[model samples]
Target: MWNQPYLETCCRSALHRLTLVGRPGRPDGLKDGPCLRRLEGMGLARQREDGRFEATPAGWDRHALEIVPRKSA
Candidate 1:
């Protein structure tokens, strides 16, 4: 589920935002709280002791499929 690139991308983006606060140590921002929790629950992401969430190995294995563009007839 989370292995999908699309999901991983979303998780990465969320993590970036959470860490951008520059507070240093533990993420307490509510903006990413819910999304992070959900990602953790889904096993796509995990929170480290440092309070930062990292993508799991499984999350990297999934790939998101994209629709190919058809050539003009």
Candidate 2:
């Protein structure tokens, strides 16, 4: 349970959203409220001093591994 923390549907989506850069109207980043908060609590995302949200390194890795579709090898 420690290696990979569980993520809800909303949080997973938020995590994926965090990987996106320069989103229009998203000065800080994805603001999915509770989802973002949960991700932050789980160490997946962090809020910048400017009050914007961004994915942490762990969040990026998690998104890559769990969200990004893998090509069949």
Candidate 3:
């Protein structure tokens, strides 16, 4: 249980989108700019040299723990 930064529902959705494996790590046009920027500010994601954003390692870890649902035992 890490004291991860609180994410808005929309930003959380954006982070999940960024973490999608393969399938082209593209963003949803300008709609995601602010959300991605916020994630960058939190060190959760980073912008690429080509002007696209990708999830950071920290982002991936956060996504797994916070975004992904756990299987009920």
Off by over 4 Å in 2: 1-3, 22-31
| lDDT (CA) per prediction | 0.52, 0.75, 0.83
For candidate 1, what is the lDDT?
0.52
Residue-pair clashes per candidate, as listed?
Answer: 1, 1, 0
Report the lDDT tens digits of candidate 3 across residue range 9-71. 989999998888433565536797889899999999888777778899999888888899677
Q: Model 1: per-residue lDDT, tens digit, 1-47?
A: 53443445555555454344333523645666776766677775577
Backbone clashes (count) for model 2: 1
Best by lDDT: 3
Tell how far residue 67 is off in model 1, in angstroms.
12
Q: Per-residue lDDT for 4-58 in model 2, tens only? A: 8778888888777778752321244335778888888998888777777778888
lDDT of 2: 0.75
Q: Candidate 1: where is the Cα deviation over 4 Å?
A: 1-30, 63-73
Ranking by lDDT: 3, 2, 1
